[model samples]
Target: VDQGHEVHVAYQTSGNIAVHDWDALRYAEFMLEFSEQHGDISEVEQKLYRKVIKFLRNKKSSDADLPEVRSIKGLIRRGEARAGARFTGLDDNHIHFLDMPFYETGRTRKKPLGEADIQVVADLMQKVKPHQVYAAGDLADPHGTHRVCLDAIFGAYKWLEKESWIKDCWLWLYRGAWHEWAIHEIEMAVPMSPQQLRRKRQAIFMHQSQKDRPPFPGSDNREFWQRAEDRNRDTANTYRALGLAEYEAMEAFVRWKG
Candidate 1:
């Protein structure tokens, strides 16, 4: 910001225990609510109930508050993002980690895009008066996080725009864990040399647990590194396959359209 570039990172959720306690609590809460209010208990509800019970049994030996778990996950994600940004040249202060509220529930279902989330983001954008805002927009993300997160970012940007704070800033959306922008489609391709790749990996390492056990919604288990490396190499290789010069790894981004 001091040097004229202002950037921000908006995470969609407290992803740390997103899968464990968050989902588990959601399972428990839903079962309790459904069993009390509704007459027909669908298989989905019953299934979730059973899962919640299992989680409780598991938690019997541990201490895990919903917010605490979410916070831990948030910190891991925040640290990794900061490290990645540092490796890529964005400063630590440039990043604003908004640990959005609706996600704090130990329950499974998160709140809709509320004023609280949008206001905080909008205020930041307004204060910075940034020329650009980069966000994750993986609406097709299987975990539903991509969708929820994008909703919040879009909501915030739109709110800022309505308040006339958006005239100076352009919002850019990057796909989340599942995908990256194709080379031909990329408006910006931040290439990583071997040294940079090492740095990027170190940055990714800051994510700690996410590097190993990302909050996969279901049983398909693969580390974030495996996914990211495969995606990065495949992207570079694809470019090579298409006759472009190959690089060790690359971070690609597409300019988002409203």
Candidate 2:
């Protein structure tokens, strides 16, 4: 928003577990508490505990009345509201938000990429008529949401093309948080100074729910901010290694072929 460019963010999933309240360590503690009280659990209570544990472990439970899902949604809403507040002083007219209906964790995965999903994005593209579109680069995302999001964006672009609505809009794919783009795959590299990096980190911190310990850290135990900084710095280092001008940090993106 500070760059005087119109920015539209479409969150494909709620990212429920991306908050500080639902970390793996806390889940493990809950499991231990359940185990200690297992003997006193009635048949109905046992089933409830099992369901909770399964959800915590990133597994889908048969029971639909799980409180965890609701809690996740609440966390997501608050985080989004906080994010919006951070940009209140900026040019709100240049910022837009589009949230798609999708699950946060892998437990309640949504349906496969479909026409409706594609159409929604295609309509947005047609309306915006943007010069560029940045889609998610599904890199090492275990839950497959990123891949599905990419597919939806691709489908949307294809739909727009068939309708002759896609003009000269270019698509850029970015990967971060979970993984970074490979050195060979980076087409456009954006250099960031120390102040820029710090500002970026501050923006990330607005999602207070995702600050200290996110629910799904995957195999990487580092916090999301740390992971982001490390990935960006590494990309900058790779660029320098290739004889590019040294930068304090860099964000790499790969242009989508299709």
Candidate 3:
């Protein structure tokens, strides 16, 4: 966006399943409190909260979340995504939630990638006609959401490869917490100054829901921002070791042929 490029962020999943029950319950409780404080607690709102609370109380570890619970969690994630986008200087209109069907199972185990999911991604890419597309290259994510989303993008590209806009479009992949791009695989190394790195950390902090005690902290146990900073600094160190200029941090990306 700073480069005068029109940038849009499309979140392909609601990420409802990753929301911990405790977080959902607290949010629900807050809503109940908010409605009461406003002196407009509708009977329907009260009833809905009652139902959600009851369902959660009896919910087993293996049981799927109630649809109402799932919706609340999804909204929570959407709110966080929008907040993160805004923190990065994006307007609300430029933020999109694709909510791909394959990821709406309300369970950790998602459905296989389907044609509908591909069409949703394809439609967005075609509509945006973006010159560059950046996607997560973390196929080793234990949750498997990253892999599923990457697959959808690949599938979408197959549908749009013949389109004229695609000829100008370039796809870039960035590694996630699981790993960083190898030095040989990195085609672009965006060096970040100290202030820029701090700004990046602040931007990441916008996702409050994922802070402190995220539902799935994975094996590293560090916060998302910590992991990001460590990975970036390590990438920069690697570059310096290779006799390149030292940077506070770096973001590495690989241009995807497909």
Candidate 4:
């Protein structure tokens, strides 16, 4: 389970615009519960949203392109990531929200990899010097964040290697929540029990803002976790259909780029 060794996850983006308005609204409400260590600050956060709701109430007409502030959007996604990590048995301290510099601007449009992003990753890698480093390897990521993230990680790894800090680290690649490693290609498959499947779904729920809103703007209409779990379950089923033992769910991985 790699429990004793520190495992660090640097999810690169907030995945805010992946769902719809109604879903975003509801998710924002649920997220209010976990916004702080104290829990359930609906009075205060909802008060903030009320200002927006009130503002939207007056808009009989508005700029088609202009939308709500990105800070609100980023807020929901961060809460979702927090919830997802909790569902996966990830300790809050071990999970990091790099929320990479390039993703700070809400839109998918991004600038090239810069020192800001490289330094954040480099600092984390050096700080953790983890026994294992796992990252999203969805070369097919609808957005190029995965590609850019991989580039930054590889760049950091190269720096670490030269610094003599990461030669002993085990590297692993995880497909985005969108995709999974092919049956024949998986190097490591973490099987999930029925309970874990539910937990994964729960984690996906943490990203509620993406569930029904402009969420991650994916190819499918299904919520992110729905798509993720179905794909995960299906991957496991595919394995079983191909004559492997059945499992409730499976998050598969492959070898590192190096």
CA RMSD per model (angstroms): 10.8, 7.8, 1.2, 5.2
Ranking by lDDT: 3, 4, 2, 1
Flag the better candidate by TM-score, 1 or 3.
3
Off by over 4 Å in 4: 1-5, 16-68
Whose lDDT is greatest here?
3
Over 1-258, each residue of candidate 3 has an lDDT whose tens digit, in order, gives 777878899999998987888888888888888888998988998999988987887789989898999999999999988988888889999999999999988887889999999999999998889999999998878788999999999999999988998988989999866689889999999999999888888877877778887877778888889889999999999999999999999999999896
Compute each candidate's TM-score over C-alphas.
0.68, 0.73, 0.96, 0.76
Off by over 4 Å in 3: none
- lDDT digits (tens) for residues 1-258 of candidate 1: 324555555455556554444444554666567785877777786765665465555675345543434544455556666777676567677666776776666444566768887777767767777677777766656656567766776787777666564776676666546767766677776666788667656767766556556555344366666666767777777777888788987676777666
Error of 2 at 247 (Å): 1.0
Q: Put down candidate 2 lDDT per residue, 1-258, tens digits, no spaces.
A: 566766665555556544432443364356557766676556775565556556656644353424554554454655554575454434444344444445432354566667766776777778878888887795578677788778888888877776554657889988778788878788998999998898878877777666666656678888778989999999999889988899999988899878
Q: What is the lDDT of residue 222 in candidate 3?
A: 84
Query: Can you list the residue pairs that collide in candidate 2?
Result: 19-209, 20-209
RMSD of 4: 5.2
Predictions in order: lDDT: 0.64, 0.68, 0.90, 0.69
TM-score of 2: 0.73
